[model samples]
Target: MKKANKLLKEIVVLIFALLFLSPIYIVFANSFKDRGELYESVLALPSSYSFQYYLQAMERMNFISAFGNSLVVTAVSIFFLVILSSMTAWMLARTNNKLSKIIFMSFIATMLIPFQTIMMPLIQFMDQIMRLTNIPMLNTHGGLIFMHIGFNSALSIFLYHGFITTIPKSLEEAATIDGCSKFMLFWKIVLPMLKPITVTVIILNVIQIWNDFLLPSLVLTSPGLRTIPLTTFYFFGQFTIQWNLAMAGLTLTLIPIVIFYLFAQKHIIKGIGEGAIK
Candidate 1:
């Protein structure tokens, strides 16, 4: 009876999984079909698969440039976020002072505030800073990356703080007794031990920053600086929508992140499991 119940549960979960994935499947299938076939039957298999829409979308969207811009922004933002958040969390974890506790709590508190509430004010502040300093904060990759770091740091710091607390302080003490400096101790001893949580942080931030649309849309105005999501808007127009082209563009945009997740999924799962245990 127990085995039967487990099997039945698995079957139910599988059904739900398929249901969740149906929209993605529909988009992928329709991407290969022409407009008429897509409109006629979205769920049906394409009568003949063709890459024409993909080719057209790629050309119209300037996929290569947009892809490069996204890669640069995501990579730079995650790099700084991981380094800064990890160090900040490590400090918070090791220090038991009231100030540290208050600061850590402050980071956690920011996570409760919705991004939508601050979106307009954030943009205005950036614009004001740009005007005051004569800096190109808007319509620039650096500006977008800076915003990503600010927005993503709270969660990253929280995750790192939780994981760092689980680590033994004796490890740092031992390193110190051997004459290792604080920086070296952290770099050689503590950071390596933080692999599991670090992987989780990287994967989470990568996906968030890479697929972000609204933030990028508000920050990036130049056509040359558009990300994949912004570039996909080319398929949309006032009078008519290029559904087939839009689908193809979406498929292309999804492929990179899907491939990245597939490659890193094992590490991600392992990190989460280990972090949970710790």
Candidate 2:
């Protein structure tokens, strides 16, 4: 009976796994086919594999510039997000006071507010700031990254805060007695111990910032500043949609983050498990 139950559970899991992966199979399979072939049998495999559509999609998408924009935005945003949020979380975790609690709560509250509700006002406010100060807040990669950090900090801080609070205060106290400076205490002692949660924080934000579309769409007006998703949008026309090219574009867009997530995925699991264990 135990063996039969285990086998039944495996079968159920396999079913769900196949269901989850079906869209990926469809997209990748359809990407290699031409329009006529795609329309003829959407689910059927192509007669021959071809790189022609991929090359065309890359050309039309200005793949290099768009890819670079995405890399910069994601990398830069995550860099600051990790550093700033970790530090903020550490401080909040260490400081047992009403002010710190209030600040931490503020971060949590921001996460509760839906982005759709604030998006219009956010755009208007940024535009006004740009006009008033001429600091180029609305349309540049810098502005976009700044916004990413602001939007993402709460989760990063929340993760870091929970993990930090679990750490014994004795460690920081010992470091202080050892004549370690405040800066050194974090850099040399605390930050190193935060490796697990840090990796988790990084993977989560990388996924979020990399795939985000709406915020970037609102901020980036210049063609050169378009990210992968924005470039992929050109394949969709009101009248004439290029199914093959769109699929190829999607595959390209998915490749980097997919590879990244695959490699970093284990770390997320390990981190969570460790946090739970602690």
Q: Clashes in model 2: which pairs?
A: none
Could you tell me every candidate's TM-score relative to the true structure?
0.88, 0.90
lDDT by residue (tens digit), candidate 1, 1-278: 99999999999999999999999999899888887887798899999888998998888888999999989999999999988999999988998999999999998899889879989999999999999998888899989999999999988898899888877799899889999998998899988998878898888788789888999999988888999878876446421477777888889888997888788889867766654554
- The C-alpha stretches of model 1 lying farther than 4 A from their native spots are 1-16, 237-240, 269-278
Look at candidate 1 and give me any clashing residue pairs. none
Q: What is the Cα-based TM-score of model 2?
A: 0.90
TM-score of 1: 0.88
lDDT scores in order: 0.87, 0.87
Off by over 4 Å in 2: 1-16, 238-240, 269-278
Number of clashes found in candidate 2: 0
By summed lDDT, which 10 consecutive residues of candidate 1 come out lowest?
Answer: 232-241
Tell me the lDDT of model 2 at 57: 78
